[model samples]
Target chain A: MEEIKEQTGHMPRIGEPAPAFEAVTTHGTLKLEDFKGSWLILFSHPADFTPVCTTEFIAFTEIHPKLQKRGVELLGLSVDSVSSHIAWVRNVEEKMGVKIPFPIIADLNKEVSLAYGMIHPGQSKTETVRCVFIIDPNQKIRTILYYPLTTGRNMDEILRIIDALQTTDKHGVATPANWRPGDEVVVPPPNTQEMAEERLKQGYKCVDWYLCKKKL
Target chain B: MACISPDGKPTESGTKMLRALQAGLKSPEEIAKETGLPLFRVRSGLRELTQAGLADQKEDKYKLSEKGTKLIK
Candidate 1:
């Protein structure tokens, strides 16, 4: 585990500030700071015009409105040119009738891909594997998900992350396993012995002092 | 073939460009200037509108298609 950790140490970890980058996208010249005020999902696929990526793009489009409602913006990246991205998006709209509303970065130079560690040498030397970076409004990397080139990502889990993050931030509570909105939340454990003893008498449902559950 | 999907809705930029076309704005630059959208946005919106069969490009100018006209009406 230590060897694996050392090998992947260059990749940004959760709670770290996301690496800043600026590049031309289908929307325009956009920078990481451009999305600083809103939650951003910065994801990368292997390449354009591929099968799994196509389905993923369509799925992302279907969830774009939901993400926007939660104040999250989506940005995609690949080591393809802007023209290729445009053609591929247009092709998707034309062929599949699904419009991609978000901008995709044309990281032809692979600068942004390299910075985000999207390129897995074991996966492919030239193309980026599927990687998703969930960044918070404060420009912090909140979560990172990596999928192999053959697999697509789960849209529900992506939305759930945003919901979980927002709910926890607002209520100062942690989510339990498989916790969806409205499910009971895990309460922060008490530090003092008196508080621990009193925790049981409090209104929360406690499996133990350290494992109390509450609804916010 | 229908340009937009059955469940498709017009995006904000798409609507603005459609309104600009309705107002006789032709070129993308003219549409951008009229709509107060960025040039890049206008370009992309035009592409989407054209693909969605909401706008027609003639020479360097764009005008609303019949479907787009009905939409605005």
Candidate 2:
């Protein structure tokens, strides 16, 4: 595992600049900088023509417009050739009749996948594990989620995270468990004692100064 | 039809941006301020709106194209 880690370089953490790359995508050759001004969800599947990945693609497509309305773009990746990616996307569209409206990276060389630490040696040396990287508009890695090979991802959870991250950035607050849009958001705790005393009188739904929820 | 039936309609943000452009908001900052949207969102929306041929950009400013003007109620 350490050897694989050394080979893949360090796995990117939250708050790091996304590792840069230029690679062949279904849309065309694309670079990481191409998506700089937009919020991006760069995800990696194990392979193309797989059942779980297919369902995920359809689900992702289902949310594409919703994400677009919120200023987000989707990019998929795998250690497959451009032809394979193209064929599979077309097959899904023809067979399942679901249009995949995003560019997918064909990482046949695995340079992009390894750089993003998408490949898990323990899971499968040849394939990337299910991984999701939610990058902000500033190109900062905001959130990362990894699912096992067998399990598919939830579209609702994906949308929820984007909402949570965007809300936190816009309103300077954190989300509580199972947060949805229009729900009360948790306010940041006051640092100074003076502010803490004033926090109670501020009319938030407060159990204590450290724990307060407010409507945005 | 698919689950998402996008019948060539502009999204809410896209519509707000088109409306902003029609109201003579030129720069992304101005549009963002007018529509109460995030500056980044305004910038991104301008790119998409331009790509969709509903808006045009000259220098740093944007204006609604004829197609965009037709969509505004």
Candidate 3:
């Protein structure tokens, strides 16, 4: 069972512009302007050097090539020291053979965590829960995902969602459950009788008037 | 594939980069070019940095998210 608590501080939502920030990273000082015209996948974990977070970070990097091809960026966050990020990156690369390709925010002070609503005091003190934000090139908060401390997020699902979002925006269609690229898409429901009549005759994989699937 | 901190924001280590951010440094394109990684990757990285109680982004850029220069230690 999950315990819910009152939200605090600049909570993000789908379709909302994401809160902005400037932070030091392994590479250098990073600003939001850097991401203009690109998609971003921002995520947070409780801490560095932990077993679960370590595995997830490695997995995210594993799909870096694929994500990049899609024009998406990946960043990780936790209230750990830069030293911890370095050690964890080394451990993941050395033992697992996958290098962490992105910077991990050393939010040692928790200011950034609170701003993004990543810190859930009800869940735990002195750490953040698993929170993921899918931001678009416009800096809009396109999607949000929160996971419990016990669960590790699925990278495949994430990439799938990105594919779905980009596809929908590009093609003017929606995604159905378990949707994948090259699969059929769902046509938005027609609001008028005229569209319904034309919908059936249109060249789409229409299971019915309101539902259709198409290749991405 | 080591990214080699493409932006040259001057982080001695990943953690130190974050610390310097907490203190302040906000440039996105520099981060991308310096990292040799994708621009989106840098944006996502900055977001994560802020969400984890460490950094912040503003006016389309990011700086150390810590509320102030006040280090707990």
Candidate 4:
């Protein structure tokens, strides 16, 4: 485990500021600060023109508008060149009938990839594994998800997590497992006995003192 | 058969216009009337289709290119 940890490098922690960098992408130069005041979905795929990555790109394309409606911007990354990125994007549009409307970073130097701990040498020394970083508007890392190369990601789950995170950020509450939009949210428990007693009469559905759920 | 735009994704109106063109609507007015879309929208959709190499215009008449025909299929 320690060896694996050393190989993976430093993993960014939740609530800590996300590692920042400027990179050359298919859409030209982009800086982390450019995404200030908007939620950013910074993700890494293994490579371009690969089967799994292509499918994931199409899925991401399908959800682009939905993410935009929620004020989320997606930025893809791979250890590929800008020319390769453009050709792959064009090929995807021509063959799959889906436009990848997001910018894909060309991290040939592995600078940005290393900063985000995306290049797990144990997985593959030359390629990045599937990794996702959900950064909030305040630039804090809110969530992280890692997937093996064989398994494709669930776009709906990503969206659900974003909704859950945003809800918790806005309302000071938590969500149960498999929580979807419009569901009742869980409120944090009261700190004192008097507050616990007050919480019971606060019109929430209190299953117990520490477990209270309410519609927001 | 690529649908090209700034995003390279076809818009609803663009798809409608392409369908109307494939169905033998020759002019923008004909496409607009057939699809119940505005003339301006039809014109822009035609422009997008043409720019995407899916359609061709000849003497103010619109026809689907081989690529456009394959796309509708």
Segments of candidate 1 deviating more than 4 angstroms = A1-9, B1-73
Query: Per-residue alpha-carbon lDDT of model 2 for A96-185, expressed as tens digits?
Result: 999898889899888888877887777888888999999997889999999989999999999999999999999899999999999999
Best candidate per TM-score, number?
2
Clashes of each: 0, 0, 43, 0
DockQ of every candidate structure: 0.06, 0.05, 0.15, 0.02
Q: Report the lDDT tens digits of candidate 4 across residue range A1-216.
A: 887665565778888999988787775556787677779999999999999999999999899888987879899999999999999999999998888888899999988888888988867987889999999988999999999888888999999988999899889999988899899999998999999999999999999888999999
Candidate 4 local Cα displacement, residue A156, angstroms? 0.3
lDDT score of residue A23 within candidate 4: 83
Q: How many backbone clashes does candidate 4 have?
A: 0
Clashing pairs in 1: none
Candidate 4 regions with alpha-carbon error over 4 angstroms? A1-7, B1-73
- Angstrom error at residue A190, model 2: 1.1
Give model 2's DockQ, 2 decimals.
0.05
Off by over 4 Å in 3: A1-7, B1-73
Per-residue alpha-carbon lDDT of model 2 for B1-73, expressed as tens digits? 0101157577676778788888763987788789886564466567667777888999989998888788776
| Candidate 2 CAPRI category | incorrect
lDDT of 4 by residue, B1-73 (tens): 1224457656566777788888663987788789876343456467668878889999888999898898878
TM-score of chain A of 1: 0.95
CA lDDT, candidate 2, residue A179? 93
lDDT of 4: 0.84
- Worst lDDT window (10 residues) for model 3 chain A? A1-10
